[model samples]
Target chain A: MDNNKLQAKDFITIGIFTALLFVVEFACGILGFIHPYIVASYVIMIPIVGSVPMMLFYTKIEKFGMLSIMSVLLAIIMFVTGMGYLGAPLIIGAGVIADLIAKSGGYKSFKKTVLSHGVFCLWICANYFPVIVTADSYRKNLVDGGYSTEYCDNLFRAINSKTIAVLLILCFVFGVIGAFIGKAVVKKHFEKAGIV
Target chain B: MALKLDPRTKLFMIFIVSAVVMMSATTPLLWAVRITMTMIPIFLLIAEKHYAAALRFIVLYSAALLISFKFLSENSKGFLSAFLVGYCSIIVQFMPAVITAWYVVRTTKIGEFVSAMQKMHVPDGITISLAVVMRFFPTIKEEYSSIRDAMKMRGIMFGGGNVTDVVEYRMIPLLFSCVNIGDELSAAAVTRGLGGKVKRTSVQELKMGGADYMLILMFTAALVFFVVFKYMK
Candidate 1:
């Protein structure tokens, strides 16, 4: 593809991808089965899984500039939409970290792509650490307030019990699935279309 | 020259105002002060011929403040003070950041901002990510508008149904699309040379000028005073 045409395609891809991320996050929240924590987990994971397609597009099109632009854009959107006060900083920080990992692994290489997702997973895990602590505090508060042992037990069950464990496992499994999908889609479409 | 304050300066102002607002939540006087402080950037933006952008910021912040306050009030006792504190702190904390970011984007080119990050020893991955985020904002906004339009065409009534239904059914799709977009974009970034190892340079340079230094100092002083005053009680 000529340089101008390639640039236009890259821009369009970036636009589409940004919209896709927002939509997926919204859907996860709407599904009702996933709690806010799970949704937040998805938000953290999506970017990591995203590394695959990013590498594919850049490799084919040779327009590396979009990476930085997209990272900033995601952070701004999260912040403006009132995701959280820390949303912008976290997105920016995570994006940079993920990018560095991708860079170090040699962009588009299998090792680079897998490591990027791993790094993203670790970040998501770390982000939820505070929530775990908060839940523990709430549990203690319930106990101290003379709530029934059953109530306290249920509270713990709600957070650290079977449901949370199952959810976390699901997140990890889905993350892996996303990575694979990213790889397959990029390889099938962009490469075949000769748009890369 | 719009809102020509340095980012560091604005950051300091945010720090001070947030501290004071958080500390004296029930005091109407403090809330008034907080509101006035929040207005500084808005006024500056208006004076600098960026009134429309300033209004957009106001609307966004106000919506966030209202939602949070409503939720807090519904959920907690002694919520009045907490709500006041929460809203005041939000305005104080976020307005300056927004203003500073606007100034950064307007005065300096993206390339220059990247170079500035480089000079400050920010990692290449981070620098690139920051750039991507800046570029992504407008695109996402456009995407949101398009989705909203599509929903309207489909006769997805926004407010005519059960509130829970509207949020669950209508809003979810829009949000899902955003996450999907992020997934695609992240992949695209990796394919590009974003994570490359060469010592990268920018097309423009961000230099710290005297105005920036002065603004930083003033903001720092204000923050310190507010913190000390609040804590002394």
Candidate 2:
């Protein structure tokens, strides 16, 4: 078997980690309904929470395209769950770039993995794309879609076009931070257990 | 007869419903179209003998619609009302896509899904990975519940009040089991010739029957009606 080509095992690993990551995202998503600020804080919540599985995934990454495939799956899931396709480009873009970053490190260097995971985490901000891109129409749609005026106000206040830049930065920074935490936890638990 | 729709048709239904879901229904006519689109999946669920789920979804969706229409409005105030409105509105807005997706996931077998995707010429990586993902949600839920049960037995409630610990206690164990399961799964799949260089054949043969075409036509009509009405003023 050629070591360069991803096999059935690699795809299964990607699938498992993607499912785990989506579970984390769904859990954090339910919390966002309580407050729009919590919605804004998905940057902090998902990356930190989701990084555990992802770090484990990174350890299994011997070849390329795994991260990218995971991102495509994430985009498909986001659409199916009614999150819209406005974010597909950003999600896949981040995934491929993250893949390349990790590849440059031979998928082993800690610094590149951290940066790759950070780049990968930028996909979380894709949730806010519709809000930022079509500000007026989206607000109107929210109101028309039965969200109360106050909810729309708060949601918009917390996540408008201007705030998206900041949100993106926070997503990346916390992604870097979460990668370290994820790596440490993986080390503490999986490496000791020989799973890693 | 049991209404066994093609997986391709199911995928089309998901595509249409999600597109409609992205755009809000402004007028009563559009809302009617949207509601009809939503009901088709529930009806399919019922047809598939998922009566309990169908009933639950219907009751919850109707209740949310009634509350949103009668009590909550654009100007509903206060935190409790806001919370209520938020939940109800979310239900009203995303219920169709959720119901369709749920129906698809619950009713379709993994073999059929993979064969359908194969027929459509999707990449093997995405297809296999997505099939695993679709097949794994229930396993994850089962694993999570068992973990919760074990945690409860140990009196580790709420991770002793530390939020990170709460996350760590649950997540680490879940990951451990999932990785182990993935290993087992890949072994099983490879034994079944999953990654062979030759194209794999399936026991499940996919064909678009009458029901598939009919449902596809209905969904396409609904999507076109929605976009034209909502956008082309």
Candidate 3:
């Protein structure tokens, strides 16, 4: 029974950090859209791009359920705004796992922080899963929503193809690389500013 | 008198619409919904006296809706088709929902919303964070513009500069300030005793008036009809 009660300050901290998540995520979204050609691949790089800010945030707010609530809110907004549906349920599991990892080192250990974030990055893959795996339902929703089946089929066929396995594997590989980079960036920048 | 639907009512409308959009409820219903959803933003903007903006939004939404309908009905092939079907179509689908959300965010004061949530027995944790999020986004927009201006003075062009350099210069400083401001906000919130265990009260009256109830009733009936209709068909 983890009975740690959050205070007003904690809520404020949560608010700020949640907003920060949106801020960084929104910034990255802009970059992804700018190139147009790399947008698909850029979507894959989001967890890596987003992990930099998450590093500082995780260190600053190490309490349980902090990341969980953040993930849930972000995922819900994403789903509602037509971003991804699978992210919400998938995030709850990832949030708990990340929380456990952070708890192991009392959140102060850099190695634990890096590892926690590495696992946390897995939530980024949730949005892509339905597109890649349960693609029929994905197509069904669009068609149901007034899009033509022909369009949905043509559009998603490449993603629904076998390259999906490669995409999933690359997600983990990027997670490892991204978390290490996040760990480094936190030390290099945030620590000096005492923001972390 | 101009319509003064309670913030909660507005939320309920948005919520049901979102659910309909999410479920992809039924095709005939969805055709009606697409038009109805587009009207929400128009009505909201007009209600707020944003005449020009309302006109612009309706024009763009209608145009995108038409473009999507045209392309989608065709058996599109290759990247152009893929992009239109995959990307543009999604945008077209989400436009009304996005615009409705934007309207709600723009029109509703956070104080009223929190009070409404309180009346609805929302946990303080959720309400507090929601309040904070409501406050923080506009600040970020302000911060973003200031950073852009500062970068402009320093010869860091967003459009022309090296992409990585632009990101580093732009994002790092934004994150830095965000952290600093976050700390400051926490400190301020603490001073105000925002995290206290007692029930927080608000001056705003969250009245579920007759009109509100009527609207909710109608919405529920329509939703039920659609779901049943989908099953029957």
Candidate 4:
């Protein structure tokens, strides 16, 4: 394919992905399965999944410039769309780190992709830590305000312990699954699409 | 029609509202003002035809409020106050960002936005990764829907069974699928020369126009006013 045509195709793909992410996030939020920490995790994971097709496109088409373009766009959307201003910067940082890891692993290998996602997962843990700490403090404030100390204490414990455990499990399972899917799909689609 | 102002302006407005709301705890008046401020963003979202997005915000805020009220207070007095504080803080913090995002996505082409970022000195590899993720989000969603359909076809009723059973068997698998999609996305980014070291120039240049400057100034003024008002108490 011509370089221009390839660039256009990549743009379309990115737009579609962003829209999908918005829909999934909205659905999860409405279903009550999404909390602050989950939102953080989900946003961080997006680039990890997105990087595969991006790399494929770049490799095949030799249109390396497109990647930076996509990142800025994604960052702006995340920042401006109430994902939190910090989210955009954090994602940008995570993307940079993931990219470096990918490069260090010789970008062409599956190991690079998997490692990048793993790094993203670990980096996003910081986002969740604040919520846990805040919940703890809020609970303490409630106790001081003469709320049932036991109940507040229990809630705090639930959030700090059980909630964290569940989140960790989710991260591990999702990270591994995302890695496997990326490997399979990239090998199947991009290689055949004649883009890689 | 509600927020016709620039996104940068709206962002400033949110910052001012948030500062005022956070400064004085246990104040119904402050909470009400903050709540009313939050309504403006929702109105903007609706005006923009993003009703689903607006509804999502309402649900999230409502849940946060309920939790704060139920857990933070012993009496009705404290409950209402805590709820307002909790809810208003989130709205105040997030609303402007959402409104700004809506404006950007609606106004600028995605490519242009990405180009602007590159011009501003973001690394090439990082930029590419961000783009791919944004790009693949929709594809993943479609994939998820198809998977969900397949599961339904196989008689897997989503959210209709025993809570534990649904969580253990159904929800877990669905979440796992999302992870699988992420993996695919990463591999695609790597093969595309995302981490390559070639200096890149984007077609878009995010210049600070006069309007942007004016909005920033206004934001600064509002922030100052909020600070003064808080300390005066």
TM-score of each: 0.52, 0.97, 0.86, 0.53
Q: Per-residue lDDT tens digits of candidate 3, residues A46-159?
A: 667677778767776657767766666667566645554656776667777887888888878878877777677666656555466556665776665555455555446545
Best candidate, DockQ-wise?
Answer: 2
List the candidate numbers ranked by lDDT, top first: 2, 3, 1, 4
Please give the TM-score for the first chain of candidate 2: 0.95
How good is the docking of model 3, by CAPRI class?
A: acceptable
Structural RMSD, model 1: 9.1
DockQ of 1: 0.08
Candidate 4, B1-233: lDDT as tens digits: 43334433444554454444333334445445545555655665677677887888778766765555554554424444543544444454455445444444454454664675575566444444445554555555576677678777888776787753543343334434544555565566446544344555544545556755765675566556555554567
Model 3 / residue B200 / CA error / Å: 1.3
Model 1: per-residue Cα lDDT over B1-233, one tens digit each: 53454343443444444334333333344444555555665666676777788898788767665654454334333434333433443454455455544644544455565666677676454455555555655656676678778878888777777744564454344434544565676677557544444565555645567866765665566556555554566
Query: What does the lDDT read for residue A23 in candidate 3?
Result: 69
Model 4: DockQ score: 0.15
lDDT of each: 0.50, 0.92, 0.68, 0.50
Which residues of candidate 3, in runs, are more than 4 Å off? A1-3, A27-43, A83-86, A129-134, A137-158, A161-169, B24-29, B159-161
Q: RMSD for each model, in Å, please? A: 9.1, 1.4, 3.6, 8.6
Writing each residue's lDDT as its tens digit, candidate 2 over A79-190 gives: 9999899999999999999999999999999999999999999999999886788789877766765556777889899999889999999999999999999999999999
Assess the local accuracy of residue A18 in candidate 1 as a C-alpha lDDT between 0 and 100.
50
Q: What tens digits encode model 3's per-residue C-alpha lDDT throughout B1-233?
A: 35566777777766666655554433656567556756855786798887887887788777776776677566555655555555655556567667777777777888898888888888787777777876888988889899999988988786786765666677678788877787788788778667666677787877778877876776666566656766667
Clashes of 1: 54
Candidate 3 local lDDT, residue A113: 77
| Least accurate 10 contiguous residues by lDDT in model 2 chain A | A139-148
Q: List runs of model 2 lying over 4 Å from the truth.
A: A142-148, B72-74
lDDT of 4: 0.50
